[model samples]
Target: MKQDHRVVRRTAAALAAGALAAGALAGCSSKNQVPSIGYGVDAVIASYNGGSTLGANSGAAAVFSRVLTGFFYTGPDGQPVADTDSGTAKEVPGDAQTIQYRLSPEGVYSDGVQTSCDDLVLVWAAHSGRFTKAGPGGPVPLFDAASTDGYRDIERVDCQPGSKDATVVFRPGKHYSAWKTLFNAAELMPAHVIAAQVKIPNVVTPVQTGDQPTLERIADFWNNGWKLAPGKVDLTLLPSSGPYRIDSFGDKDGLVLVKNEKWWGDQPRTPRIVVWDGHSDLKSKVSDKSVGVLDVGAGSLGDVNLGGFRRQNLPGRGVEQLVLGTGGVFGSADARRAFALCVPRQALFDKFGHPDYNVKLGLGAGPLNSRTVQQDSVYYQAISGAGDKYKGGDATASQAAASSGMQNQTVRVGYLEPDEQHTAMVAAIGDACRAAGITVIDAGAPDFTASQLTDGKVDAILGGTAGMPGPSGSLNATDAIASLRTGAGLNFGRFGNGRYDAIADQLAAEDNSGTVLNLLTEQENLLWSEMPSIPLFAAPRTIGFGDGMENGVAGPTKEGAGWNMDRWVLKR
Candidate 1:
């Protein structure tokens, strides 16, 4: 679940203009005269390849969930379910480390090409962390993959030239518990399209032969090829394998999806779906019958008129936290602790975590204590009350600690601009830290990117720790390991502790439930003491369905409201 830190922000006026342009196109069609369903999104889609580092976001995940078909998809319960319509995955008998995948005979891409083993091999190669280039310090991955958790354990993939069947073998004693999640539709791209882009005769041969020059070329294209803009997208490079295909896209207008003519599975009930930017004027759009469904942040729920709509609040898969940098004014453990002590977690929670919202959402109303376990889970244990000291806004003890060597020190706090919750959170931090003789500066920007942390542009970032959902509706331990382990890909805070990393590793690998719970407790205690990041609250999302729609429930996973868009029916 590792993703880039850039949050998409577009003004309402800009987005409305873009939506009007897309609306004009939808009005041109009369045969399928049903009105297009308008779905709202929060971010701009820069890349459609969710497996690549650049495309790993909620915006891309929601759009691609309908445009791509694979062996498995995240179900309503937040677990991976086998998609028999696309393919079949089963473990080989007598060998727990081997799994075989066979694509459906009728599965084909939008361009009339059959979905085959070549696509699987290309996805595996890009995500396996196998292709690397020599750096001055060490080897660096050529392809910027979002996460290599399960893929790195793969030994080899066996497939013929153009077969639809592929066999995957894992390394000896390397049994990944989340093996069912590998090569999902969100991660699979068209390999033939990529091969043609790089002028390679075929994708299977280069991966099988370990052709360095050819692999490097493929990696270069994989990393930077699929990036999109409002009017600059090349449709040929973005073919669809699922029931829907991207008819048009805009940064502010969002994505317009139409039924794929080549799709062989169940046809989509709605002929067209327009994913509009949720930042626009949703109230008016819904009233004018232009927008039929709204998926927005819970904080913005007040802005929308809920009349004639069925509204439900969903507990988001991401956790909001203040990510502290490891190499700045607050680099030392003591300084980080002092800052945490001054944060008013309870007050912040009381303001944002209204009991009414929690009651409707079926969520616990409090700040989350553990980064690994959600508050509503049976395995949740409040191991550390260390954060209890920060309930009040008083910072007398924090001030005493800062007086020694860090008095009057200026700390810059960064966040994604145009965000109401994050902006208020940053302001609250400034107010609380002011009494501690610490000057907190607001450094939020509209174009803030993840590189700011590593490049020292900001000392801390108030962002969400978006993790992949596990089988039990909790955050996956593999994602926790990826975010905290030493030199791990998702370790944005650069917090490293050998003991904590070991506990996370055991938690991810352990099959026994009791052992995993104990390991999670150990990990929580360490995070509380280390103060690498302060867990604020589990972010909440709200979805509203107009009277004209049916089966528009929100998903608990990262795909948000459109996880099951193909099943939605629009009433005439």
Candidate 2:
């Protein structure tokens, strides 16, 4: 039942020296006169929310994170810092879960309307999923959000209209490790613009103004009205509070941003920034010295011929995953484990140019990156030893199959066809599993989305999860585990088990940081034991900055290559 596949290794040697240096380091600085910075983005941003900007693509995330200021900012090393420059948040006295926020009086949208508590309330509602059950669809969220961790626990919001102050109280006994990271600047979209377009009846009201019907109407416009296209670009409609605003969107799939005159913070170093899409030829871009900056995320270093360009190792915030569909060929734990045991995880990572790209073999010791978990932590030690169950390669896989009668079993695995590296990795997986009597069928698709696998279109999927770092510089397992829970929005594998859910619930209730880490390790152990999904490798963030681009840094900051973008300047 072994299927034929080609396993080719890209030149991973290009990133060996650069990855060793580690940490966030700036590229070569310059004082040359350059008109603007032309950087490469990962996605063609069309919508301002929902399935567009906040989705899996990091390009839209980069733009939103920079232009919109949040209550908190994540440093290059993934630590959360309260952003007093734009706003201030303080815990209310006598209330363990209540916090008060005050915005800068100078903060205003591009249209001159002051950004106030109303905006924060709107963002909190959208991300909290509080109004989801109010709709007719029965527990369906009005607006799709990237993460709903801290917001979902919100009990009440007291906002002073026309003022910049608001108080938010969450339900008691709830624990959120990423409380500060939830409402970061990148997530605070323009509320006034959305309200105006939606045309809600009563304009000025308190934080809880929108009812079920009114909120649905507003959500409809908020999700679709902000979408931009060539010849359909409405410059006036896209009002923003960030340091920059959308100037123009070209028909050729290019986006341009210019300085925001209403910006409340310090002026950015570069006045203009342009982003292009689908430009995979980094070698040509570097050789021509045309592209000033490039986000080489999970790209092959062997193909990159760096001459004068600087390779900056971005933070490893992505994990390659192999998800098994319980309803399909991997209906039983034994079947799933047999195939996982045969997978050449190292080989698959090698093809992605691991080590060179600063890619780690797995989450290392826990659900988060190795850097976040202490070496002596119980969770770290558990994950370190958890790999023993399936470490024998072909022999281990063959034995697992023999025990479960899964030998020569056929399993269909799907991945995005456009992702050359993923395709190569899938091929490597197929080659490795063949000797164990498992056949991995290639089910490639164009631009694979979460809906595809979740809807049962594919039996198994080659997927990934982005790292969400906490205040202590470690990765939080809450969002990752929450998303994969049965019926969760991002749960594409349809993995459901009461035992797993109970463990996850227990993990969520633990208040102490140490307890959370131990629980995270337990969750990971349960996941590995069940074999619903196997962690492949952490995708390394890599970017090549051309000459004249000063203050360009690459690290494992959750913000991607744009972490220090405000300070980035094209030497003029």
Candidate 3:
């Protein structure tokens, strides 16, 4: 695979991104001399679902297209400027019931509006009757807004007393840190520019918290508020704070973005261009000679071979355990344990997964075969320490104690969804389980929502998970326990224990991963002893790219061109 930082992987599915480098060596092409002749994709970007953050998970959406820029920037070491650790919403836990955040003095909007505490209020207050008349999306029990926040913890946004001070706070919602989780989806928006002519006062913050907003009226008000003003917005634009911005643009599908001269940390290459042509078929449009340079993007990985292009293979995050339905079908913890023990993870890893993906993992973590998700998460460690649980059904381990101390009459295996790679591994698991005297039926694929497991018919299915990725990238035990919070997506296995929960909560709310390791190690053993979901071979992230594409790296690898859009230039 053409692994390189230029194609850094992103959240959602696959991110489409990048500007073409100028070059005309053997394979990878060079950029166009005429600005009018810049290159871009045609069909790869059929929709605009990703937005600037590339927050959504489509492999094809994120690309070199510049996200609107902010005036100031957050460097690698830039301070987060937290108000306090205590309170309902802070990253750090404290005695207070709320935590607030202020924009850095360095913050600036592309339109040049000073980013202040009010802007923070504008973005975080969507749930506090600020965004719309609809609702806040997080901390369901506390504010009836948690569920609406689209899986994040967010309570309110507020402007502080001055230009230098902006604050975002998590409310004392029923759920612990639930408000903070909701804000995970938030990005800094141009507050002054967006607010200048806002037609609706509610829009100072968003009303609907769903990834898909419900208030069309408010959306229109925000997007076209300037039409009411009938003038161009003088908002400053820059690439300094953001990864990319519009320097110039092609009439139809091409754009030129310049690295922010005011960037605080990294010095990105200058004048990145993105162009698209809908004139031909999807494949033809991307490979057309008229396109000039070949830009690296998520969508570009499907068919090309990076090895053939002499590009390096970037590393991806490790895979997580594929848990099956807990309450729905894989009812007994022992039954789950038995199934896991029967999985041939080692075999799969040697053959298809990471050659040596034997990394620590936990309840909320996935396999640590790659760098895709944070391998150092507490969740991953818990799963890893529990590795022994898979010894079930095997002669070496004692028979798993049935939740009811009886062998499961019917064991139905489930899958997370369409990762496909997981399905193949599950088949391997089923084969091993069958040998252990367990009857496992392939339940086909799962819906992304995981609702399929709730239906009585599905006993178990293939599954995948994610965890926080701090630098070390190993799973932390406390993270595993905290991950069991009601409706926490990755804990579909429904793992539990009073001590584990306490550990999980403390670890999740705090930055102490080291202290939780031993606890997680024991937790791993207990879970493995019981076998909830067999830890299969960690999923391997693979990449490929076609010829004629150069100066760009592939996704599924470190240092890929996917995120480093500015690094891309033509090779002539």
Candidate 4:
């Protein structure tokens, strides 16, 4: 939902006052003394390409937000803010479906190559799902893109040879409201470098010619070439267009980023940033002055004892839920509903949700009621009441419902290993489901990946769905379509519903807010009735800022504290 402008102004004023009191308002006058600050992240970075399927983790997103500049970024008020320094996007007159993008004249990669139309075309081709190769079974997508929601609607991208501008045209009758999110810098790899790697004259030739073989070769490199490891990094392929570039990387020492000398924008306020894993002894490191900022889970706030650190609770863009598979113990809708009835959603929230954190932030201190919208959003509708029969661990009703081929059935719950929050949630589910004669097995794995959802290794998954709101401040229906529609890329639960998909598509294309709210109500009702997933509390994130660390605020999006890292100021 659209945040009140008054709240945004108040928050800004308070932060500015705090910065002045801490002497952090001095605008880099002491340039000779470069300040190096440590930033602890919650996950390990696997790749620099956060837009790829293999690199869709928070660690990669945090780093890429600093190393790459784009046309727009999520602002402090949770709305898109245009970045004129990188580029500008404008809609063509009388053509709502066409957008023209022009890169800044001074835009150049760290390797001194001018940013051009090649970069734009590369991102479009990779995400459009236009290129494919024959697999053992059939044709498979050449590029392993994370999600091709808005990009797949593009009719074509028009660009002049060697020009720094491009025109994107969507297919007739297809209008994407979230067009601003397309072609983020993190998705724009250096096309010149990829062309050299594939021994091609340029990337535009194959894309323009539709040469399948050449396109396949380029796709193969894009899929596997940019992966990051602990100690191994290829500098030639990792050029930065933003303010920073990777200087060093290690599993133990963490990743280091230094200012990009070739950057054309204003210099970054912080010269060097050291990123550490939050799973390590971050509290001790903060006390010892080894770490200066922390992005941690709200559940761990109780253990933090940093006296001078400023802690802020940021509402996450996702909701933790229990997703059921289509086969095995949860095959039937009745069985899935029974399992949802037995789940201790309240218990799980009490254990890990940190209600006090939300209450202090002026939000409801209870389990989330809607899957599509956050609790505090103005458009949120409390549809969970329709499933009141499943509230507060309804063992009797669950037992009665589980008697039909569901009694004594065992279901494995999969989650990422070493996650205290998920582990505790799984244990609670087991304890509550016991009364219904259902067995909940903990299938935690160290190397668990999203592939498990399709492999059927686990009957259900304890995970979350990203909850990005639309421009109107309501949960974007297109985002819901990506996760719940039949055969959607992010539909890990193998859920399929033609009716739900139709309503979601209509909601995405409709600009009328009243009609959207009605559609959302219908969508939530279907989700609760079908039990594809059980909605839990809204996920909570906390940011801890050490002394002299200014402008390091937590964003509501997945980027978290690193959303504005380029503007962060450190006073020693």
Each prediction's RMSD over C-alphas, in Å, is 7.4, 8.2, 10.3, 4.3
Compute each candidate's TM-score over C-alphas. Answer: 0.86, 0.82, 0.55, 0.88
Q: What does candidate 2's lDDT look like per residue over 461-494, in tens digits?
A: 7644521111012255333565556555545676
The worst-scoring run of ten residues by lDDT in candidate 1 lies at 3-12
TM-score of 4: 0.88
Point to the candidate with the largest lDDT: 4
The global C-alpha lDDT for each of the candidates, from Candidate 1 onward, is 0.68, 0.59, 0.37, 0.69
For residues 309-408, what per-residue lDDT tens digits would candidate 1 score against the true structure?
6666656655666778778776787777777777777777777644245542224457767665666566664453545565546756466446534467
lDDT for position 472 in model 1: 13
Q: Report clash pairs, candidate 1.
A: none
Candidate 4 residue pairs in backbone clash: 1-473, 2-473
Worst 10 contiguous positions by lDDT, candidate 3: 73-82
Ranking by TM-score: 4, 1, 2, 3
Better of 1 and 4 by TM-score: 4
Q: Write the per-residue lDDT of candidate 3 for residues 1-572, one digit (tens) a residue.
A: 21212222121112222322223354433343232233433212221211111111111222322343322111111111111111112344544344445445655544454445544443343323333334376522212121123223445444433355434444454234323333221133444544444443433434324323434443443323312011222223222234454454333334445555544334444355554422223234434544443333222224532332323222233234554556744566655655565666556555444422333342112333211224444355344544533433465322532333324445655542333444565566666666555656666542232334545556653432222110001121212232343433234444455654454444444445566565556555655554444444332333322333334433332112233344444443
